[model samples]
Target chain A: MRDQNRQFRLAKRPEGKPDHDTFDLVETDVPDPGPGEALVRTRYLSVDPYMRGRMSAGESYADPWEVGDPLRGGVVGEVVESNGAGFEAGDIVTGDLQWADYATAPGTALRAVDPDLGPVSTALGVLGMPGRTAYFGVREVAEPGPSDTFVVTGAAGAVGSVAGQIASLAGARVVGFAGSAEKVAFLEDELGFDAGIDYSATDDYGAALDEAAPDGVDAYFDNVGGPITDAVFDRLNVDARVAVCGQISLYNATERPTGPRKLPGLVSKRARVEGFLVGDFAPRFEAATERLAEWVASGDLQYRETVTEGLESAPDAFLGLFEGENVGKQLVRVSEPDE
Target chain B: MRDQNRQFRLAKRPEGKPDHDTFDLVETDVPDPGPGEALVRTRYLSVDPYMRGRMSAGESYADPWEVGDPLRGGVVGEVVESNGAGFEAGDIVTGDLQWADYATAPGTALRAVDPDLGPVSTALGVLGMPGRTAYFGVREVAEPGPSDTFVVTGAAGAVGSVAGQIASLAGARVVGFAGSAEKVAFLEDELGFDAGIDYSATDDYGAALDEAAPDGVDAYFDNVGGPITDAVFDRLNVDARVAVCGQISLYNATERPTGPRKLPGLVSKRARVEGFLVGDFAPRFEAATERLAEWVASGDLQYRETVTEGLESAPDAFLGLFEGENVGKQLVRVSEPDE
Candidate 1:
């Protein structure tokens, strides 16, 4: 075990879009844990769209990662050492353990990462927050009724891919929008989506959406909010429900993207659009994750992990989210499990 | 009675927006009704923004007015003679009377107009359908919880003007938006409103909206759907309810208006925007109207009527709705009450 920790901290606050200069990788002596805290050897790290929001200094869902402070998100690791806490050495646990080789945290935040349900690393993907997000949005927000059509953007992504499958399981007709032909094919062919549209080559999203969803949309689970979302608004059926989960497309934009008007549509159609943060449902999270884990075990839910091999590549993995490089959930392996 | 009935019919379907040439007025002999029908002598006529959509030869909430046929809408009149049906002579009623001197309607479509309810002319304005629209929207659609702030646009117009008063009676902080200073003052001084904004003088709507509704909007009753509507969206607090009743702002535009880009906000804010048609509430329309009439009689709900005297002036009265001419409700006086 190393006596030092390698940390990646926010070097400076990003004004608009972030680049390489915003992060600073630093090495420091590993500190001893206080009572009730355990030192964990991180093996996997979670990178998500929400972390980008935390990089800015202001009010956000997650506390902003201040300049010179180590960045933290969902991490799965075995406890190397503990200060008389419930966690023991060799016990695998998960929590927000930062972008570091080793992290010390209170025992309360840690959850036992059960490997038999699926790969332990999946605690950051299918069996974790992203999976729970898809569950809450599908079951709580949209709640697709009989023979309803569910439209999802970023259909081949972590939250979206899971959302489509769950929506289908709930007896809804599932359609997805993706940026590439390959993703569109993957979503439709491999994932059991009723329909998929390649938004990359489609210039007129309104017409393409019309062709894809001829009957009009009943519920929209939006991951990318821009013109594509506006196009969906134009074709929304009366009394439709919209779950605004993420705006990955607009997160990095220098200014707010301007698109076709929506207030009239909101009034004329009497449809509903709502935003949600997954963490709000954290109290009932285990209930969602347990079902997701069971679904994956029963083959009712399938997930693809876009894995980056090493902890050193975590920055690249984080940046890839904005570029849409991830097919499903994106995670980085900090260390190999003892075989 | 004259044998010839003067009728205003659709001359041509408007491809974009309506013009003078789109409507044609003609003279024809009044047609006699068959069984279960009553011949209605048109006395008062309704000219509203919703009629513009009925003029188009396409699918909408209401059926389109066919070319060479008499245009039809809500008409208040007396039953001169009943064709072996329920209606009797001197029976004041409201029904789908065409834009002509006399109309033949099935007994199912007609309702006896109560002469004791203020002015029978008010059946065409406040204390009537528009008033009912306000009552139901505030009580049902935009159900403002206590401490909720209700914001309305096109605040001086019929539906919105009434909505503000009803919201205030329901113990909501009412803020309104209108085109002119005089109208804004009327909303604040004469009508019961917490705040009023003159949209014409305010160059930056977002800032002005933020100023007026600094605490944030909890409910929005939208009558106009343009830039002003967009501004309301940005100022909405989390979990806000938006009742989109009408979009008079876009009624005359040749193309769809370009304004606020809101799907992103919808996603981030978790708000619900729903569209509704008053006709859909048929199961409870009488219940709503009864309560509204009671409120008006109690002097709890006040109203204004922009009466354009004579059926020949009905076209100009309707056109006046888009121009913000009607203070409360715009109607045409087809006959003198004593006549």
Candidate 2:
């Protein structure tokens, strides 16, 4: 085991889009596991769009990361050492941990990663937070009916891909908005999405929606916000439901971006727009994860991963989320699990 | 009995605010009652903000008025003649009727207005559409709890006045935003709102809210959806619920106005914003109206009205709504009931 650990720290609050200067990588002594704690070597670090919110000083669902504090997110790792905790050495686990090669966390915070659930790395993707988010967001919030037209933005991203598929499984006509033709192809050809629109190809999203969602959008899962959302709001059918899962488009905005007022439009449609966090459903995580695994095992659900090669690539991987550079779940591979 | 009927017809769609040119007053012979219909002499004409949406060429929850159609709205009238319909000659009734001295309609489309429910005009204000809007919006959509901090915009207006009081009755701290010091006094003094912000007194709604709703807003009932709503969105606490009741501010806008995006903020707060029309709760309207009437009868609720003396003033009364001219319900007294 390495005696030294490398971790990324928040260098400063970003003004807009985070650049290389926003993060500082430093070498430090590996944290020792205290009583009821475990020392885990990270195999895969989850790089998500939501992490960008933590880099700011403003209040959000998760507490902001202060300058010089180690950046933290979901990590799938192998436990190397345990101190009076319910875990054995070499056990695969996942928890909210520092963006580093190694992290020490209370054993109570960690969950055993079932290797049988596809790949161990999936503990950070399909069988994990993103998957559970899609499950609850679709079932509880969006509630797309069989005759409903379900529209999702960022169709190729981690949570959105699963959300569209889940809506499709519910017998709704699922339409997705993706940045590229390849992502559009993935949604329609692989995920069984009824239709897909390449938003990058047209500035007039309303026209694109007119073609893909001819009947108008009844349920919308918004992972990206901006003009795309404006267009969706314009075409909302009566009694529509919008689950605001993420706003990757506005995370790095230096100032609040102004858009056409939407609340007024809601009155005519009698629609609902709700924002939620997956952590709010932690109590049901186990049951939801099991359901997700069952789908994956049955070939009813599929997922792709864009893995960055090393821990040093974590910042780049995260920045790529805003750039639409990753196709599916963006993960930073820190190490390989022991055979 | 009057031999001539004076009616207002939509001459053309307004580009911004409707003016005298938009409506043409015409005098015509009163139509005889058809089978199963009654001839009703207009007594009171209800002028409301929602009417503005119907004047546009664009589609809305209510069907738009085509050019050259007689302007129609809520009206309280006395049945002069019944043709095998369920009404006596002297019965006071209310229904969607024309803005004319007399209108003939099937008795099935009209509801008898009980004079025992305060004055007959109350059927157009506190005991009518506006009151029922407040009832369902607060009880079903906003759902304020005992510990909640409720904020309402257009607090002295018809729907908002009742909404704030209902939230207060639910044991929530109610703060209201109104246009004038007098309206603020009506909200805080007469309606029992905990605090009132005169929006016309300051441009900084957020600063005013910081003082009035220091703990942050938990439930919001929005009637005037512009800067006032933007301020409330900024101060929303976690799990906030926003009930979008009306948007009088934007009813006359020739083009959509832009404002700071609010959905992104909903993510951090896990808030829900829903829009509703009172008509959507039609099945429950009778029960809801009874509850509202009970509140008014018990002196738990208070109401005000700004009545125009003549039907000739109907267009002006409606235009007044956009200017924040009415304190509570705005109505035009078209004729007097016989003793």
Candidate 3:
């Protein structure tokens, strides 16, 4: 009960790729819960591409992470102590529990993580925030249908991987963009992408996209919006929709860099490109989580977790998302099996 | 039996700005109508900006004009004779008729022009296709409400003038961009535009747009897709919708020119910029035209026509749209107008 809590605090902002100096592992006391609060022992800490934006001192669509503060993200954990009436001890939960060994919330931040559906770790991947993101970005923005050819960028990662499968399930002809031949093959062979284009292999990305989507693309799920996006813009059908979920490729630039050839393609194609935050649809969380769990259980939806063991390994796992290291959902498994 | 026919033909294609050499007028014998055809005496002719695209050789969104051929456009006229059973002589009609004093068309193409709607020539401008184009571009594409701040480019031309007014009527605070001070004032004074920006005045177009629309633009009705539009693009609000109705500024452009440097702003703001041709909404013409007529009759809408008298002057009227010569709708009163 008196185990020391190890916390990774931000040391300095990274210029491009984060180094070990950017993070500090410090020992902190496990504090008691006050009125209407609960202490949580994190089971899994989710590492996402969006976390890269928070590291910058510059303006982001979301708030920037302050230096010297603990890095925070969505985590699936167990509540060890509670003063809130509804959520008691031993309940599995998911919320914005920071990158420390344990966290305390006002019970308002944490939600019950359903264990029967699949794994509790899925709360950080398919059946939680990322799932809600895929839903809103696809259903609300892209609105892919059976006749539509849906194209997804960053198709091997947490959100993009889920978005591609969901579009396919909605009867769309889905094509994915991944970094390597292996990931491209994985997307097509295992994940059921209609086609896959390895962006890292080709200089003529436009032609590669053309080959993959022989028919014109109706909607584009743009997780990476640079040249990959400009190429996709050129291939868009009339009245296309682009859901801009992230721009990971540009997030860590040391300076404001020049981007790919764009605009004329955007206007000529008559497309709609919109940016969104998952928090915009927070009201629909319960309904979305329920449906996401059902799909995962029925095997209609697929999810995978790239788990890094131990709380001390959390920083490297997060930095790995920027380098495209993880295969699917990246999470740090914080604690060993409970007796 | 002896009413001779005459047609003004497109003798040569214009390089940049079309000149008088591009046209050739001649008298020819009238051809007899076959089954499903009727003889239409051209009374009023339409000379629109889009007609410029038709004059080119190839690779346009619209069909090109044939060499040494009598040009055809939206015409309001009288049915002189008919091989088709549906029409009778002296029935006033409007349709795609040749740029001539006398022309023939399928009876199906001819709609009996309502003479009682103010002046019959109104059929060529505010009461017809041009009017419907403004309607759909503003309502369906921009969809600006009272709370919206609307910005328009080429804001004193046929479609642009109507678009600004419609946006104002929708309770939007309207700002217009015009080539001259006179046209700018006209948009502000007569059309109820809150402000008018003379784009020719300075290089600070984005600043000018910002000055005109302090709250930032909610909807942009873009007819000119060059720098003027780029200026408007720089001032869009979050989730803003831009209806790219026409790209007249780029029509005769020798090379693809770029400026108005604020595209990436669209991503963060989640704005939508899309190109549209009025032909895409041809199916809804009847509904759109009827509403436009009612709006015009009730004085809720206003129209202006830069009429060039006689069929011989149609070329000058057509070329004037590009030079910013016309204040609003440009038309050629091809005959006595059947008065």
Candidate 4:
């Protein structure tokens, strides 16, 4: 076991986009597991867009990480030392853990991940929180029907990619809006999406969306909210459903930004907009995981990871999310799991 | 019977607020009813905020009124002449009719008003579209819990007034925001609302809303959408439900107005916002009306009307809706019913 542990702690609350100054890396002794806890050796640390929300000093569903506290998010690690029952050494697990080489968590909080079910890192991506978010948002919130047109923003991101794939599998014509031509090509060429629009290249987003979704949008999975979302609202068909999964576009705004008033459009379309978190579906997590695993195994669903090589690169990896630098799930590899 | 009928025709679509130039008063010969039709003497003409949407050439759930077309709205009239089944002179009936002293409509489009239950004019007010709107909004969309703090904007207007009353009777603590001090008093003192804020008297709507709903808002019934809506979005509690019933505040804007982006609030609260029209509830109208009538009879759902006395005052009555002139349901009393 490594005697020294590397940790990234929140140093300051960012007013807008976070910089290197927002986080501080410190070296400390590896944490020892207390009673009913297990010491996990980190393999991969998940960097997500929602983590930006926690970096700000405000109300969020997830508790804000105060300055001097270690940043916490989805982490897949191996149980190297155990002081609790049912958790044996060498067992792979995932949980909301500190960004450290070693994290000690209550045994009850960590869920075991089977290595045979693809790479265990997937427990942090697909077959995990992002997967469940896409599953529930598409099925429960959006409820896309066969022949319906499903439009997803942030189409190449972790959650948006999974959401688009699921909607396509449900027999809906899927149209996606991504940042680049490459991401757009990935959505249409690899994911069976009916069409993909490079939102960054378009000035008239509504017209672009209208051309892509000629029948109008029946279900919208919004991960990036801004002009793209505004355009989607204008083209919503009657009884449309919008799942407000993320608003990465407006997360860094120093003050409230305004767009075209959308309630009027909602009334005309008789639409519904709902925002949700994966934790809201805790009871059905196992069921969702099983279905997601089946899809991954059957080659029906595919995922990519933009991996940063070291613990020191975590800040750059996270910041890259805002710049649209990463494709699919972004992760920081802290160490390799023991066989 | 008068041979000449006074009609208001759409002369031009107004740029902002409609004026005399937008409406042209015309004199026409009263037409006889054809088969399955009835010629009725107009009694009360309903002037509502939604009519403003129809005046514009755009997409709305309600079809837009074209130039040279007579203004049509919900009207309660006495059947003076009939050419259909269940024909009877002096029968009070209600249907969507033109802004004229006398009009002809298919008998099937008109429903006989049972005066014994309540005022026949209620077929256009509390027991009609607005009431049904409030009913479904609270029960179907907002779904307020007995102990929840239910906040409603435009609380003194037609739909908001009834929405507040219904939420209050459902055992929710109802708080309202209105345009004037008198309307605030009308909501709290006369209508059984738990609290009321005169939005016109306060610049900080969020502060006023917070003071009234100290426990945080569980359900918000939005009618006049704008900054008031922006304020409510800031304080939404977990699983909050918002029923988007109207955007009367922005109805007169020549251009699409931009306000604060609100999807982030929904994410933190796991909230829902849905838009609906009463026409969507046609299949359940009978059940809703019966329940509403019982509430009215029991004094649990009292209503008030702001009546303009002449047919010539119809356009002024509608324009007054934008100015927040009418306290409750605004109507034009074209003529009196024969007792």
B1-339: candidate 3 lDDT, tens digit per residue: 336777889889888777889889888988777899898877789988777877888445557888898898999888878997389998889998899888888898888877777688788778787777788889988989999999888889888888888888899998888998998889878888899998788879888877888898899988877766666766677789888777787778666544433334555667776666677788988887788888888988888988889888888888888889998888888667334
Off by over 4 Å in 1: A57-60, A84-86, A206-211, B13-19, B57-59
How would you encode candidate 4's per-residue C-alpha lDDT over A21-114 as one tens digit per residue? 9999999999889999999999999999999988877877777889999999899999998997369999999999999999899999999999
Q: Which 10 residues in a row give candidate 2 chain A its minimum summed lDDT?
A: A330-339
Provide all candidates' interface root-mean-square deviations.
2.2, 0.7, 3.8, 0.8
Which residue pairs collide, candidate 1? A72-A98, A269-B275, A270-B274, A270-B275, A271-B273, A271-B274, A271-B275, A274-B270, A275-B270
Clash count list over all predictions: 9, 0, 0, 0
Q: What's the TM for model 1?
A: 0.94
Candidate 1 per-residue C-alpha lDDT over A1-339 given as tens digits, one digit per residue, 9 for 90 to 100? 777788889999887778788788888877677899998888989999888888977545567887999988899999888887698899999998879888899999899888888889889888998999999988888777767889999889999999999999998989999879999989988789999988888879889878778889999999898888888888888788888898888777667677766755665466777778787788999889899998899888989999898777888899888888989999988887672
**TM-score of each model's chain B:** 0.95, 0.98, 0.94, 0.98
Is 1 or 4 the stronger prediction by DockQ?
Answer: 4
Q: Which model, 2 or 4, shows the larger lDDT?
A: 2
Question: Model 1: per-residue lDDT, tens digit, B206-288?
Answer: 88877787888999998888778777887888778888888888866666677645766665466777777776676887787
Task: Quote fnat for model 2.
Answer: 0.92
> lDDT tens string, model 4, B1-339?
787989999999989988889999999999889998899999999998888888899877789999999999999999998897365888989989999999999988898888977988788889998899999999999988898999998899888899999998789999999989999999988998999999889899888987999998999999988989888888888999999998888988998899888887788788999998888889999899999999999888989999999899998998898888998899999998542
Candidate 1, lDDT over the whole model:
0.83
TM-score of chain A of 2: 0.98
What clash count does candidate 2 reach? 0
Separate DockQ for every predicted complex: 0.52, 0.90, 0.28, 0.86
Put down candidate 2 lDDT per residue, A113-221, tens digits, no spaces. 9887789888988888998989999998989999999999988989989999999889999999999999999998998899999988999999999998899999999
CA-lDDT, candidates in order: 0.83, 0.92, 0.81, 0.90
